[model samples]
Target: MKSLICLLFLALLSSPLLAQDIFSSKNTHFSFFSSSPLEDIEAKTEKGVSAINIKTKAIYFKVPIASFQFRQKLMQEHFNQNYLESDKYPYAEFKGKVLDDADLSKDGTYQVTVEGILNLHGVDKTYKEKGTITVKGGNITAGATFNIRIADHRIDIPTIVVKNIAEVVAVTVNALYTVVNR
Candidate 1:
């Protein structure tokens, strides 16, 4: 009986359930674009961090608001100080789950919908966005594009420069993930 119990324990330890299920990317790319009649504003940053758990279908992402770089220095300054108020809300984060049951271990592309709360400018709003995830050779890559209304996040635009900024901005995210060794 003791031998049988030991065998079961060994089997459990070697099971696929015990394998690495978490994948992470430290340098995720995040960008946003605003188009208006006056001008178009764009910024991008690669300092974001993201993670996914294949077993639980959980996803998480966080990026510093001030890390975004604009083409013009003045625009970058205004974005951090006046629009985003980066000093007050240092980071924007998303915590959500993948709605699809895609086998991440397989090498294929999967369409996924993620529903989560996005905390930006100290306001939390729920968003459901569609994204594509490609798994190849034990690596995963995810890309998504979504729109965010400035009013939803309580971001106020001064009337004087209102024409330069759009009411809704297009946001794009890309991440290349590797398995997290435990």
Candidate 2:
């Protein structure tokens, strides 16, 4: 019985789940753009954070709503006060998994699909999106671009500036991750 217990302990020690294969980044870049006949709106932020577990295929991302920067100050104010209600929602986040089952330890560029729940402006939506993850020399870089409809998130638009905003906005995310030392 002692020998069997020792064997089980060894097996658990060698399991991939026991390894430290998590990669994280605190300075992820996130952006969104809206183009309309009246005007084009764009915002970006580098204050986002992200993490990925290579062995478990889990991924996560978070960004403060107020972190986004706009070209015009008034537009930023409107985004926070009127559109997103940043004071109420505070943050946007995504929790998902890497679906392609690709080995991230190797050095290669892989196109993959990630399915997850995105919470924005106090709304949660499931998204299945395609993106590219490049692993080179233990460094990981991931990029994805997707669209979100404003109405789906319950973000209301006043009639006065309806033409200034689009119903759909294009969002892009880029993260450079380093291996965790756990």
Candidate 3:
């Protein structure tokens, strides 16, 4: 009985279904643009990290709040100290899954929908966004554009500068992933 149980355990451990194929990117690009009547604000960062599990269709991303760079130094400082409060909330994270049946192992382009919870400014909100995934020569690229409402995350914009910022911002993400050997 002991030997039988051991053999079963080994078989379960060696099962293909239990083995996960995970892809990761260390330098994912993230950017956001806010257009208002008074001014247009934009920021970009390449310090984000992301990972995806092909078999389970799970995806995750995390980016440091202070890593974003703005065109003007004062804007960047104000963003970190006043708007985003990077000292209090250092990072933003997303955990979601690909809601498509496309085979990621194959070389093709697939349109997908990702539904997940985004944690920003110490608030969590559910978002459903559309994205494109392209697979070529054993490499995978993912891109998405989504809009986020500032109030949804409790990001307060003072009335003094309200006219300079938009109520909603457009965010874009791009990631190139390579297979991770675990």
Task: Please give the lDDT score at residue 93 for candidate 3.
Answer: 87
Tens digit of per-residue lDDT, candidate 3, span 22-106: 7777789999999999999999999888877777777888888999999999999999999999999998888888998989888
Q: Go through the candidates in order and give the C-alpha RMSD of each one to the true structure.
A: 9.1, 8.6, 8.1
lDDT of 1 by residue, 65-87 (tens): 99999999999999999989999
TM-score of each: 0.90, 0.89, 0.89
lDDT of 1 at 76: 94
Per-residue accuracy of model 2 over 39-153 as CA lDDT, tens digit each: 9999999988887778767888888899999999999999999999999999898888899979988899999999999999989999999999999989999999999999999
C-alpha displacement of 98 in model 2, angstroms? 0.9
**Model 2 steric clash total:** 0
Model 2 Cα shift for residue 177 (angstroms): 0.2
TM-score between model 1 and native: 0.90
In angstroms, the error of model 1 at 103 is 1.2
